[model samples]
Target: MNDKENDSLPVSALQHFIFCPRQCTLIHIEQEWSENVLTARGRLEHDRADSGYREFRRGKRQISGLYIQSEKLKIHGRIDVLELEEINPKGQSNLPSFHLKGTWRVYPVEFKHGQPKENDCDRVQLCAQVLCIEEMLGVEIKQASLFYRRIRRREDVLINQELKDLTRNAIKNLHALFQNRTTPPPINDKRCRACSLKDICMPKRMSVKSVKYRQSLFQPQEPL
Candidate 1:
């Protein structure tokens, strides 16, 4: 498919891709989903952030449920919260916004139900938001934030070269997977235990069966 078609990819797929490719395919490709405690809590968290409101505090403007897109990245999604801060314009003009004036820096903030994970999934997701904002606003975003409900604090993320590269690569992979319409095989790992699709995926059973099949292929036949 052409880049234009791939541009319709969802930004959330990046997080799913990072979490587990199999899970990504199951949901996006197979259209399968099941809600568990964790997912329910996460939905609640997003609902609160997706209320669609704007507030001003401490010289900063906070907007919730901001829809953003990046045709360059071929991804589109709504940001949970976007914080804008006025800054000195470095001899460059900015596009006019109904809510923003002068030179303002954009900072995307994502809300989560739990504390940070061991991987960069959350960070990459936030970075994808930043990329969208940059593309839409024609501004450079150096950082963003992720708010964890359990911790009740925002973890700042730097939009460095490494993160940008990772986010781009993830978008590429997501497009490829979606275009091919292939659902990857299940991987029975620790993350699967928490996955809501565990029952439907049957990763453990499938893994065992695959192992037995491989072993059977290698086994020698006796006199029949």
Candidate 2:
């Protein structure tokens, strides 16, 4: 059920699972990575804040490059941004009074250099973060947001029961893929253009071949 040297999985596992399990295992588990220009740009952007805390802004608190851990979920990862519900409106760093309010929030904001995606990969990744927070805080998180730098907008995501189910399934699937060590076939399209691992992923060639194979099987054996 677990690897002997198993480290806790990253919260981004959902993102990888949605993209391609092979890509996720390759990037995270094996720690193998290559830098394309897009990747490089992303790294440079993160370096701007992933190191330490910044001064509080606009009576609200902000933190960048946070490393969070959840014992229950057995997940760990870096959060790009965390909007701590400012305990003090007057600039003091007091934690929220759970005794009075009964609930508090740790709003996660993932920073992406690109625009919003057509699919739920990013949504799942962001949701994964919320799940980790829930496991850590022992509270039901209702929602979170992802901020796209290119578009300069915050897209809110609801943490409904449906997303929770999908996230759990993704984690199970991810562990299974690692054990099997099989890279799924590629799914070609415009998405390939944005994926830095496209060359290693072979999504386009694999998907084209898949379609061809299916067609041949249905062509009636060319009259034998």
Per-prediction TM-score to the true structure, in the order listed: 0.87, 0.76
Q: Which candidate is the best by TM-score?
A: 1
Best by lDDT: 1
Q: Model 1: runs farther than 4 Å from truth?
A: 1-7, 89-95, 208-224
Residue by residue across 1-224, what tens digits does model 1's lDDT show? 87575558788888998999889988887889999999999998798689998898765788999888888878989999988876754423364764445677778899998999999889988998999998888888898889899889988888999999998998888888888876676779899989999998889876857867866888997969
lDDT of 2 by residue, 123-223 (tens): 88887778776666555668788888888898998889998788777777776776677555566767677777877667766685785786678677655
User: Which stretch of 10 consecutive residues in model 2 shows the poorest summed lDDT?
Assistant: 94-103
lDDT of all predictions: 0.85, 0.71
* Candidate 1 TM-score, true structure as reference: 0.87
